[model samples]
Target: MKKDNANASLQARKEAATPRGVGVMAPFFVARAENSELWDVEGRRFIDFAGGIAVLNTGHRHPRVVEAVRAQLDAFTHTAYQIVPYESYVALAERLNQLVPGPHPKKTTFFSTGAEAVENAVKIARYATGRGGVIAFTGAFHGRTMMGMALTGKVVPYKTGFGPFPGEVFHVPFPMPLHGVRVEDSLKALQYLFKADIDPKRVAAIIIEPVQGEGGFYVAPPELMRELRKVCDEHGILLIADEIQTGFGRTGKWFAMEHHDVAPDLMTMAKSLAGGFPLSAVTGRADVMDAPAPGGLGGTYAGSPMAIAAAHAVLDVMKEEKLVERANRLGGELRERLLALKARVPQMAEVRGLGAMLAVEFCKPGSDTPDPDFTQKVRARAMDRGLMLLTCGVYGNVIRFLFPLTIPDAHFAEALSILEASFAE
Candidate 1:
C-alpha cells in the first residue's frame, strides 16, 4: 500500500468486499492508535473523541491491557470456557460479582458482545421468573442482534427493514426533560403498558441504559431510577441496567448504576470491559443466574482467555490510574466548555451526561426542533480538521464525546478547541 493510495485503495476494496449494511463512520482507515489518538493509513493524525464507539474508555492499547493480552497470547487464546474452563475467566467473574452494585449473593457470566449479555440477561430473567415478556425504554440501543434490535427504540437505521423483531418485547418512553417527557410521564407510560399492553405478571425484566448511549447521552435521572426500582419490586419484575457504554470509568464509577442509590437486579456490561478486545458480562443474583441449567447457557467463545486477561488488566489500570476521578474532572471541564459554546451557538440546545460520557445536542435556533443538518456539518468539519466525532440520538442531532478517560490533558484541550472551531464553522 503506497502512502498516496493507502486510504483510497483500501476503501475501494472494502466497498467491494463488505456489505453496505455494515456502516463505516470514518472514510479513513486506521493505521494505528494509542491512548486518545489515531493515525490514518495516509499518516494523518486524529484526536479520537469517538473512542471506538465507547469501547476504549481506558484508551487504545493501554500498556497494561496490551501486556496482559500479549501474555495470554503466549500461553493460549481460547479454550471454550464451558468445555475447558480457565482460572482467569473464573477470576474475572468473581471480580465482577464483587464490583457490580448489589449486596445480594451474585454470579457472573461472560459473553462476546453487549447484545449477547443483554439476550442472556433476558433469558435468565425469564427463566427465573417464568415470564414471557420483557420491557425496554424508548431511545435505547441494545445491539444489532435479533433480541437487541427488538429491544432497541430507534427505528431509522437500527430497526428499519430489520424487523419483524422478537415477540413479547415492549418499549415505553424514557424520561427526557429536554423533550418534555418528564419522570411522571415515563412512569405513567409504564403503568399504561401494564394495562394496555402486557400483563405485569408475564413481564420478566425491564432493561435501560443508565445514560442513553446511541440515543444521545441523556442521563437517566436518579429519581427515575429509584421509581423504576420501586415499580419492579412491586410487580416482581427484574430490573436490568444496560451499562455497556456507561461502565468502567466512563461515568466516574465502575458502573453507572453506582450513581444512584438503587441497585438493579441484573446488569449487562461490555464495551470497555476488555479494552479493545471483545467481551461482555451479565451479573445478577446467584439464584437468578442459577435458574438456567448447566447446559442451558454459554457460547463457543464465551470467555476467551485473552479477553479475560485484558479485562483483569483493565480493572487494574482503572484503580492504579484513578481514571474514575479523571472522568469526573474531565467531564466537568468538557461540560463547562460546551456550555460556554452553547451560549454563543444557539443551535447548541443542551449539554448533558454523567462524568466523561457527555454529549451536545443541536436544535434550530429559537425552536426545539432538532438540527441534524447542523450536527452533521459540525462532525464533518471537525473530521476535516483531524478530530473524529460521533453523532447519535433518534433525531441525529447529538454529538457524543467518548474520549478515553486516559486522554492526556494536552490532547483533551486540543480536541475541545477543535470542537469549538467546528461549531463556529
Candidate 2:
C-alpha cells in the first residue's frame, strides 16, 4: 500500500467489507502507535487523546507489556482454562481479589471483553440473590450484548431496533446536576422504581458506572454511591460497580470504587486491564462468586495466556511507574487547562471527570442547549491539527479526553495546544 493512498484505499475497502453498525470515529487508519502518539497509514503523526476508547491506560505498547506477551507467545498459547487451567490465570485472579477495594474475602473470574464480564457479573448476582430483576441508571452504557443492552439506558444507536431486550431490567435517573437532575431526584426515582415497578425482594443487583463512559464522562457523586449502597443493603440486593472504563488507574486509583467510602459487592473491569489485549474480569465477594457452580462461567478465550501475561505486566508497569499518581497529575493539568480555556470559549459549558478520565461539554453560547454540532466541529478541527479526540454523551455534545496516563509532558502539552486551537476554530 502506497503511503499517500493507504488510508483512503483502506477506508474504501472497509466500507465494502464492514457494516455501518460498527462506527468508525476517524477516517484515517492507524499504522503504529506508541505511548500517546499514533501514526496514521498516510504517515500523519497525531497525538492520541482517545486512548483507544480508554483501553490503553498503560499506553499503546509499553515495553513491559510487549515483552510479557512476547514471552507468552514463545510458549503454548491456548488451553481452555476450564479444560486445563493455567497458573497465570489463577495468579491474576488472586492479584485482583487482593487489589480490588473491600476488605472482604473476594474471588475472580475472567472473560474476553467488558460486556462478557458485565453479563457474567449479573448472572452471579442473580444466582447469589435468587432474584430476577436488575436496576440500572438512565444514560448508562453497560454493553451491547443482550443483557448488557437491556441493562443500558441509552437508546438511539445502542438499543434502537436491537430490542426487545431481556425482561425485568429497569432504569432510574442518574444524577446529572448540570442537566438539572439532582442526587435527591435520583434517589427518589429509585424509591419510585421499587414502589411502581419491580419489587425490592425480586431485584438482584444495581449496576452503575463510577464515571459514566458512553453516557458522557459524568462522575458519580460519592453521596449517590453511598446512598445506593444503603439501598442495596436495606433490600439485600447486590451492588455491582461497572468499572470497565474507570479501573486500572484511569481514575487515579487502582479501582474507582476506592474513591468512595463504600465498596461494591461485585465489580466488572476491562478496557485497560491488559494494555490493549482482550481480557476482562468480574471480582467480588468470595461467597457471592462461588454461587455459580463449577463449569458455569468459563469461556474458551476467557483467560488467554497472552492476555493474562500482558495483564500481569500491566499491573507491574502501573505499580513500578506510579501511573496512578501520573493520572492524578495529568488530570489536574488537563482540567486546569480546560477550565482556563472556558473563560474564552463561550460554548465550553462544563469540564468534569475524575482523575485522567476527563471531558469538556459544549453548549450554545449563553444557553443550556447542547451544541453537538460545535462539538463535532471541534473534533474535526482537532483531527485536522493532528490531535485525535473523542466525542461522547447522550446529547453528543461532550468531548472526552482519554489520553494515556503514560503520555509524556511534552506530548501532552502539544495535544493541549492543538485542543485550544480547535476550540478557537
Candidate 3:
C-alpha cells in the first residue's frame, strides 16, 4: 500500500465496514496520539483540540493512568463486582461520595458509559419518588441510548429515524439568552408543563447539563438552577446534573454543578472520569440511591477493575497536577484571545462556557442567523493547517474547544495560533 493513499484507503474501508450512523469527523486515521497531538497513518501531525470529545483531560496515555491499568491487568481483570466485589470499587465510590458536591450523605454506583449512568439515574429517581415522568431541557444532550434519546432535545443525528422513544419524557426550552430564550421563559415553560402536560407529582427527575455539550456550550443560568431546585423541593422530583462532558476538571471545578450555589440530588459523570478509560458513575443522596433494591443495578462490565484502577490514577493526577486550577487559567487565556479576535472575525457571534469548556458560536455578521457553512469553513481550514477541532449546536455553528488540560504550553499556543488563522479570509 502506498503511504500517500493510506488515509484514503482507510476511509474507503471504514465506509464499507462501519455503519454510517457512527458519524466520524476527521478524514484521516490516527496512527498514534500523545498529550495534545496525534499523527495520522500518513505521518501527518495534527494538534488535537477535540480531546476525544472531552475524554482526555489527563491527555492520551498519561504515564500514571497507563501504569495503573497495567498493574490491574496483572492482578485480575473481571470478577463481576456484583458476583465478587472488589476493594478498589468500594474505595473509588467512597472517594466520589466525598468529592461530589452536597452536604448530605451520598452513594455512588459505577457504569460503563454515560448513557448507562443516565438510565440508571432515572431508574433510581423513579424508584425513590415512585414517579414515571421526567423533564429535560431543549438543547440538552444526555446520551445516545433509547431513553437518552427520549430525554435529549435535539432531533437530528441523534434522534432522527429512530422513533418511538421511551414515553413520559418531556422537554422545555433551555435558556439561551443569545437565542432569545430567557430564564423566565424556561421557568414558565416548566410551569406550563405541570399545568398542561404531566403532573408535577408524577415527575421523577429533571435532568440537565450545567453547560450544554452537543447543543453548544451554553451555560445554565444560576437563577435557573436555583429555581429548578426549589421546584423539585416543592414537588417530589429529583434534580439530576448531567456532568458527563463537564466533569473531571473540564469546567475549572471537579464538576460543572459546582458553579451553582445549589447542589443537585443526583449527578451522572463520565468522559474524563478515568482519564480516557471507559468508566461512568451516578452519585446521589444516600437515601435516594438506596431506593433501588440490591441486584437491581449492575452490568457485567459496570465496575471493571481496570477502569477502577484508571479512575483512581485519574483522581490522583488531578489533585497532584492541580488540574482544576489549570482549567481556570487556561480558559481565561483562551477566552481573552477569542474575545480579542471577535472584532476581526465578524461571524464570531459569542464565546461562552465555564472554565476550559469554552466555545465560539458563528453567525451571520449583521443578523442573528446561524452560519453553519462559515462554521464548517473554520473547521476545514483549521484541519488543513494541522489543527483538529469539533463543532456543536443545533445549527452546527459553534466551534467547541476541548484541548487536554495536560497539553504542553508550546502545543497549546501553536494550536491557538492555528485557530486564529482559521478565521482569516
Cα lDDT tens digits, model 3, 152-171, are 99999899999999999999
Runs with alpha carbons beyond 4 Å of true place in candidate 3: none
lDDT (10s digit) by residue, model 1, range 1-425: 79988999999999999999999999999989999999999999999999889999899999999999999999987779988999999999999999999889999999999999999999999999999899998999999999999999999899999879889999989888888999899989999999999999999999999999999988899999999999899989999999999999898888999999999999999999999999999999998999998888899989789999999999999999999999999999999999988777999998899989899999999878999999999999999999999999999999999999999999999999999999976
| Residue 253 CA displacement from its true place in model 2, Å | 1.2
lDDT tens digits by residue: candidate 2, 1-425: 78899988999999999999999999888989899899988889999999888999999999999999999989879988889888999999999999999989999999999999999999999999999999999989999999999988889789999878899999998888888999999999999988999899999999999999999988899999999999999999999999999999998899899999999999999999999999999999999999998888979999899999999999999999999999999999999999999889999999999889899999999988999999999999999999999999889999999999999999999999999999987
Give per-residue lDDT, candidate 2, residue 230.
Answer: 98
**In candidate 2, which residue pairs get closer than 3 Å at backbone N, Cα or C atoms, i.e. clash?**
none
Worst 10 residues of 3 by lDDT: 416-425
In order of appearance, the predictions have TM-scores of 0.99, 0.99, 0.99
* Clash counts for the predictions, in order: 0, 0, 0
- Residue 17 in candidate 2, Cα distance off native in Å: 1.4
What are the lDDT figures for the candidates, one per model? 0.93, 0.94, 0.95
User: Could you tell me how far off, in angstroms, the CA of residue 64 lies in candidate 2 after the best superposition?
Assistant: 0.4
Which has the greatest lDDT? 3
